[model samples]
Each structure stands twice: as C-alpha cells, then as structure tokens.
Target: MEIKTKKFKRDLLNWYKNNKRDYSWRETNDPWKILLLETISQQTQLDRADTYFKLFIKEFPNPETMASSSLKKVLILWSGLGYNNRAKRLYESSKILCETGFDELYPNFEVLPGVGPYTNNAILSFAYHKKVITRDVNVDRVFSRYFGVDEVKTFIHNNKKTLLDRVSSRDLNQAIMDFGSMVCKSKNPLCSSCVLENNCKKYIVKIKRPQEAFSGSNRELRGDLLKLLLSNNKLSLKKIEKALAVDREKLLKATTTLEKDGLITIKKNNLVEINS
Candidate 1:
C-alpha cells in the first residue's frame, strides 16, 4: 500500500497525460485567476465552479477589480456558488493582495484568507511551478486506495523524493487529481478501466462509504437563506422564514449561526442582510 513502485507512478502519470480533462483553469499561470479558481472551487463541484469562474473572471478579471468592488455586490454576483462566505473572503484576500501585491501574496501563504494547506500547495505548484506536493480529499482518497496505506499525508511527506523524482510537481499533482476524479471515484470506481488497476491496493481490498444527502442540511439552508438575502439587500425575519420553507427552528439556527460567522447580520427590527 505504499505506492513505492516506479511502475505505479509511470502508469498514473501516463493515464493522466492521455485522459486529463482540459479545464480552463489548468491553462493559466496567472496567480490572481488561480487564486480565484482555487477559492471558488473549495466546496463547489468542478462544472459549477468552472461556470462561476468564467462569470466571475469576466466581471472582476483581477485582484484590483475585486478589491475595489463592494462585498454586497460581490455576494450578489456569487449568489449561486454556495458557501457565500468564500466570496467575502476572496474579496478581503484580494484587497490585501492589491495593497501588498501578488509578488508578496504568493510567497506568504498565511496572509491569504481562506487559503489552507492544500490551496497553498496548489498556488505554489501550479502558479509558480514549485515542487510542492498538493493533496486534496481526492488525492488523499487515491493515495489511500493505491498505496493501501491510510496515512496519506504521512505517506506523501515521507515518500516525496521517490514520488516526485521522475515528473514535474505540477504535472504529477494534476495527474493525481484527474486520476482520482475520473477513475478512482468515491463510489463505483472504474477499476477495470483504470491504468493503475494492476498497482492499486484498494482495488483488491475494496473500501466503501455512504454518500451524505444535501437536502435540508445546515449548509443547504444557509445557502438558500443567503440567496434570498443576496437578491434583496435585507429581509424581514418573517419573510426569510417564509422564503426558506424549512422548519422555524432550523431556519433560526442557520440564520443565527450565519450571523455569528459574520456572513449575515440582523438589525433590532429583525431584518437580515449580508455583513458589511
């Protein structure tokens, strides 16, 4: 389960080279657009993220444009992207970058709001061609199954030299992501079609998990509520409750939590609006 063999690397990289999808984000080295793609893509799916990326990039284009825009306008544009909090975070990060500059922003990962370890590695590896190993949930799943080891981060950290020696870090990381998404998916993985079929340990071991439903989840409620507010600057508590169509208690909980998170705010008169 260690993925220590050179053949495994060769097969995965080769498969990726031949089968990877041509995403617009993959074609650029622009740090601003790269940051926008990564941040917007955090919780959104691939197709939807790309759609939003096209729309958002068309409107904002770069850090300066985004930084200059108001948070409410940004959230209005970002309405359907869900996790609307990211829009605000992206705007804040853009302001910081515009002031400090991308040259400073790229090197100091900590300065960027909402940019975590995976995103940091992605920015460095893809945008700067740095030899950093980027592992998101997809890459982690692929490594766990292929290597037959559960400690993905540990495995990658320990085996970086061997894993990355034969390929460019950007290509290798991109290959892992593409392979995971296309072949080694969470459910019903296309093992027969996978190039790594001969090398994957999980193909023999067989691991599975249940998919979580999104309906009525806190995230769904929050997103719905945000959408309602995004279209209409503020809404009366009664109006929001009626618009959400969820149980009163659940709606209240979502709104209160959103207020605490600074994604929304409630006036004394009970009108809710996106936080300034």
Candidate 2:
C-alpha cells in the first residue's frame, strides 16, 4: 500500500494545529541554541531536555561564547544524559564552526557532525524556511508503520529529497515528530485515534503490537552490553558472555550487532571499546 506523503503531512499538521505542545524553543530561531537542544536531547525525555537546554543557554548563549567555554563545562552540564561523547561532539562542532572563519558564526545547516540530515533539517526547517526532512526514532517508527518499510534507514538514506520536498518542512517536521511521539507510539499505538490510521500499513499488516518483540529483544541486550563496555574499556567476548551468563551464542550475536552498529570495536583478544 502506498501512502501519500503530502496527505499524511497535512493530517499531521492539522492535528498539530489543535494538539501541539507549547515548547519554549518553538518560538526561537537561533541556530546555535537549537543545536544545543538537538544535542542535549540525546536519548532523554523532552521535559528533562528542556531543563538542560535552558541551563546550557544560560551558561553560553551564543556560538562565540560557547566556543570559548571548556568542553569539561559542557560535559558537566550534559551529565546524566548517558552519552558524554555527544557533549564532546557538540562542543567540538561549535569550535570547528568558530574556527571556520565564517564570521565566527554557526554554519548554515551544513558542516556539522552529529547534526545529520535529521538534525540539520530540524534546525533548517524550524530556524530557517528551508524545507528539509528530519527523521528521528519517533518519525522512523511512524513511517515504518505507515509504509511497512522495515529497512527505514535505507529508504531514508536513498529518498532524502523526495521526502523533504513533500512535507511542509518548517511546520510538518516538528508536527510529524510530535504526532508520532504522542500518538503513534512504539507499543500498542493509539491507531484508532491516529490521523494516519486510514493510510497506515500497520492497519493493513494487522499487527497488534509491532514493536513489542523489539523491546526485550537483542536491541536491549546489546545496550546492556554497551553500558558494560563503555564503563570497562575491554574484555574478551567469552568473558562478557560468561558475565552476562545467558549463552555464548547469544552474547556473540549481541556483541556482533553492537560492533556492526559502530557503537563498539574489537581489539586484541576480543577486547572492545566504544567508538570515539
């Protein structure tokens, strides 16, 4: 079943017109500050991200100011978010932007690490009027349900312009993300009330809870392995397998998946470390 992206975009925005959250950043167009929210939000709830975003802007409000602040201060502000490296990346990206001699300004939505298509589009659409597609986990899950494309990464990787051109990037990007986060949930989504239900492939698939198996499945297992790997630099696969105490085969599968995801890399004698 083919879903009309424009129609889906319209429905999402109309729903958003009536039901969007009044976030503080929605009213601002400062690219540097927007980038701050985008980075500090790494795997965290929005309310918490809101608090952190406010704290960060208060400490360093502009690119020139943030470029001067030590990364240690940024990491300290970013504590409890679990991914300290994103903090480092955010700081580094700012410094690079400053040193680019681009008038000590944040670049125009290009030339940013960790600021991929999604983050870039988010800033561009919200901060500027440029139409761009922004896909995060919520949008990815919703799109998968709408189109039944399990390999969403590949589809997104190949069809960037087509998708971005179809949506009202300035409004629809945030709306789609908000719609999915609030309505098109990962587990037992409120499909009945979902505006896109009529066009959703999940309705066609008739799958009650598509993301259920994914929760306790290999993904979570790999994340647990990652927490351990990040804390302790290296360990043999056999040692990790034994420590987890499930089965060597399962441990190998999880470790292999993590490695393939570029979250970890093997060293001498099955030692593993987080990618820098």
Which candidate has the highest TM-score of all?
1
Residue 251 in candidate 2, Cα distance off native in Å: 20
Candidate 2: lDDT of 141?
A: 82
**Position 135, candidate 2: lDDT:** 76
Clashing residue pair totals per candidate (backbone < 3 A):
2, 0
**lDDT minimum window of 10 residues, candidate 1:** 203-212
Scanning candidate 2 in windows of ten residues, the lowest lDDT window is 101-110
TM-score (C-alpha, index-matched) for candidate 2: 0.66
Tens-digit per-residue lDDT, 33-92, candidate 1: 888999888867878889989999999998899888888888888887777778888989
lDDT for residue 106 in candidate 2, whole number 0-100: 32
Q: How do the residues 1-276 of candidate 2 rate in per-residue lDDT, one tens digit apiece?
A: 124765666677789999987778877777777789888876777888998998889988877777798755665566566555577678778788676732333334557667776677777767776765677878878778887888778866666565666555657677877787798876668988877888878833334444446455676667567666655767788778777666877777877776665557877777766664
Model 1 scores a TM of 0.91
Off by over 4 Å in 2: 1-3, 101-110, 150-167, 203-276
Reference-based TM-score of each model: 0.91, 0.66
* Total residue pair clashes for candidate 1: 2
